[model samples]
Each structure stands twice: as C-alpha cells, then as structure tokens.
Target: MELENVIDAAVEEVLGLAQGWLGWDGRPVVFDGNAWTPHKSLRRVTDHLVDHLAEIMCRLNGLDPLPDHWHGRTVTTHADFARFTETDLEEATSRLTRLALMYRAGLRGLDPAVLDARPDPDTWTLREVVEHVAGVVYYARAMS
Candidate 1:
C-alpha cells in the first residue's frame, strides 16, 4: 500500500475510536505502564504527527529539524483530565484529519528518490517517518 493511504487509514481509525469517548468519565486508564485519557491520547497523536511532519519538511529543505520538547505520554495536564465531549471529538476529528491530509500532500510532493534518502545516516528516511506516524495507531487503540 502507499504510505499516504496507510497514514490516512491509521488516522481514520484513531478518530473513529476517539468518537467513542464522547461521554468519557474523568478517569485515566492505565496502559503499558502509563496513564491514558481521551484528551491525552488525542494530544499525543496530534503532536506525533506534527512533530514528524516538521522533521520531514526541514530535512527536505536541508535545514535542521527543531527539537520537540513534548511531554508525550508522561504528563497529563489539567485540561487532559477534562470530560470528553462531542465538541472535543469534533475538534479532534477536524485537527487530526487536516494534519493527516497535510502529510499526504507533503509526501506526494516529494520525489521518490528523496523519500528513500535519509537526511543523515542516523536519521530515518521520509518513508520510514511516515510509517512511524502510522504506528501511532497504538495511542488511540490503547484508549479504545
């Protein structure tokens, strides 16, 4: 399958599961030795997509990627503890869907050679990066 198709499918699945959290109680669920709430899962998935997107863009432009200081799955803010409502679900759907589409557009714009070329020996190729983002299904899957 194409990388973009895989990413789109993963994001769609995440959002579908997130829709199930519309009336979630204000309790954190433990998963893989970490706590996960609806907000936290959404935030993490969004952040992961954005972070790697930035990295891909910067590498394509021959620039150093900015450091990401995201707290990730470790810190759950007060807002993360909020009740998951229909409004939040709508916002997540909008934000994540757009981001996933952006990834598709960006990947489509790149040359196939560039997709396979690593920015550095230690860095992942753009294709690998997209696959990594697709793996973020685990976040939403855990919450579901």
Candidate 2:
C-alpha cells in the first residue's frame, strides 16, 4: 500500500478508538514497558507525526532534522492522568485529521525518486520514515 494510505488508516483507527476513551477507567495501560493513558497516547502519536514531518522538511531544505524534546513514550506526565472528555475527543479528531492530511499532501508532493532515495545512509528513506510513523496505531490501541 502507499505510504499515505498507511498513515490515513492509522490516523483513522486511532481517532476511532479514541472515541471510546472518554470513559477511561483512570489507569494507564502498559505497552512495551510504557504507561499509556489517553493523553499520553494522543501526545505520542502527535509527536511522532510532527517529528517525521520535521525530518522531511529539514531534509528538503538541506538542513538537519530538529531535535525532539518529546519524552511521552516513557514519561507519564501529571496531565496524562487527566480525564478524557468529549471536548478533548473532538480536539484530537481535528488535530489528527489535519495532521494526517498534511502528511499525505507532503509525501505526495515529493518526487517519486526522492521518496525512495536514501541520501543519508544513517537515516531511513523518506518513504520508510512515513511508514514508521504509520505505526502510531499502536498508541491508540493501548486505550482499548
């Protein structure tokens, strides 16, 4: 499947599962040794998306990717334990849907040759980067 489709599906699935998180039992779910509350999961997925998008932008601009300060994958913040509400769900949906669209449009604008090329042996190709972030479905699934 195309990388864009992979991201779209993941984002959709995450948002779908997130709908039921309003009734969260006020406990974190353990996944890969990380504690995942609804806020933490949403934060992780958004961070992952923005991080990769920054990488793509930096590479295209002949610059290095910005360093990420995200520690959500391991550190559970106090805010992470907050209640999940209908308002939060709506915000998440709007935020993630726009991010997914940006991801898709960004990838689609790149030349096919550039998408597959590995300019830096140290990093994954652009397509691979997109595919990697598509795995964000795991974050949302932890809420189930």
Candidate 3:
C-alpha cells in the first residue's frame, strides 16, 4: 500500500477511537507503562504527527529538524486532566484529519526515490518515518 494511504488509515483509526472519548469518565488508564487519559492520547498522537511532518519538511528543504522536547508518555500535564468534551472531540477530528491530509498530500507529491533517501546516518528514510507514524495508532487504541 502507498505510505500515505497507510498513514491515513492509521489516523482514521485514531479518529474513530477519539469519538469514544466524549464519554470518558476522567479515569487514568495505564498502557505500555505510561498513564493515559483521553486528552493525553490525543495530544500524543497529534504531537507525533506534527513532529515527524516537520522533520520530513525540514530535511526536504535541506534544513536540520528541530529537536522535540516532549516528555511523551513519561509525564502528564495539568491540561491532560481536563474533561473530554464534545467540543474537544470535534477539535481533535478537525486537527488530526487536516494533519492526515497534509501528510498524504506531502508524501504523495514526493518522488518514489526520495522515500529512500536519508537526511543523515542516524535518521530514518522518509518511508520509515511514515511507518513509525502509522505505529502511533497504538496510542489511540490504548484508550479504547
């Protein structure tokens, strides 16, 4: 399957689970050794997409990707404790769907050869990055 389709499918899975958060009871669920709330799961998924999207754009532009300082799965902020409202669900759907579309368009526009090019020895190829982002579906699934 095309990498963009794979990413969109994964994001769609998350979006489906996010709707369930509107009924969340504000209890913390532990998954993969980290505490998860509905908000935290959504935040992590969004952040992961944005972070890697930036990395892909930066590398394509010949600029270094900025470092991400997200504590990711290690600590939950006060905002993460907020109630998951219908408005929040709408916002998540809007935000994540737009990001998914951006990823799809951006990745589809790249030449197939570009997917195999690495920006640095330590960095992953663009193809691998998309796969990693697809793996983030686990975060939303954990909330389910």
Candidate 4:
C-alpha cells in the first residue's frame, strides 16, 4: 500500500480501537480477567504503527530485525492507557502526516543504491524508531 494509505489506515484503526473495543483508558479487549492500563495501551497502539514504518525501512535495507520485546502482552494499569482529548488526536494525526511527508521527500532525494544501504551495526539510522508520537502532526499539520 502507498504511504498515505498506510497512515490513514493506522489513524482510522487507532480511533476505532480507542472508541470501541478499547476504551479511552486502553483496557484489554478481554475484560473477563485481564490487567488493563490506559497509558500503556495508548503506547501499544502508537508503537504498533511506528514498528510498521520501521519494518518498511528495514525491509528496504534487507536487514533482520532485533528481537522485539512487546510481541505479545496483556494490559495492566491506567498508566498504560492514560487519557487524551479529541484535540490531542487531531494534533497527533497532523504531526504524523508531516513526518511522513518529510520521509517521502528524503526518500525521493536518496541515491537508488544508497537508499537500501545498511547503517553501521551499532549506529542509529533514519529508520530507528522514534518515540515522538506527535511529530508529524505537530510540524506538518496533517492531523484532522
């Protein structure tokens, strides 16, 4: 899928999860007996998309991923999910779009061979995951 499509899907999916299956607090889908935390839940959702973007960059370079830690986990506390308003959502979306645009630009400007070159093993590269959740939304104004 195209980058815009991927981003849109991520946003829609997150909103749906937040409004429906997952509460504002990021509770686990399983309510019967699960430890749900709101902050962590939000982080989980955010990290999912970030990881996808990272994977895309990694695949372009033909590198194996480091073992991931949160492959499977259960919700446990309010700190996991936290709380945010609709405005926060809008801002975040905007920031992501902006960052995505920049990424696109950088991708376009790269040499064909260098685009896929791997960075030094111990050095961080552009594809390294960033924890700035609202980056694109904040600077790019892509959020709606």
Provide the TM-score for each candidate, comma-separated. 0.95, 0.93, 0.94, 0.45
lDDT of 1 by residue, 1-144 (tens): 887677789899999999888878878899988889999999999999999989987887889999889888888788888988899999998998899888888888567898898766988888988998898889998787
Across 87-129, the per-residue lDDT of candidate 2 in tens digits comes to 9999999999898998888777578899889986888998888
Q: Least accurate stretch of 10 residues (summed lDDT) in model 1?
A: 103-112
Candidate 3, lDDT over the whole model: 0.87
Candidate that would win on TM-score = 1
Q: Candidate 2 lDDT (Cα, whole model)?
A: 0.87
List residue ranges in candidate 3 displaced over 4 A. Answer: none
Q: How does residue 7 of candidate 3 score in lDDT? A: 78
Question: Which residue segments of model 2 deviate by more than 4 Å?
Answer: none
Q: Name the candidate, 1 or 2, with the larger TM-score value.
A: 1
lDDT of 3 by residue, 106-140 (tens): 88778878999876798899999989999878889
User: Residue 34, candidate 2: how far off, in angstroms?
Assistant: 1.9
User: Which segments of candidate 4 are over 4 A away from where they belong?
Assistant: 1-4, 16-38, 75-78, 95-144
Instruction: RMSD for all candidates, in order, please.
Output: 1.1, 1.3, 1.2, 9.0
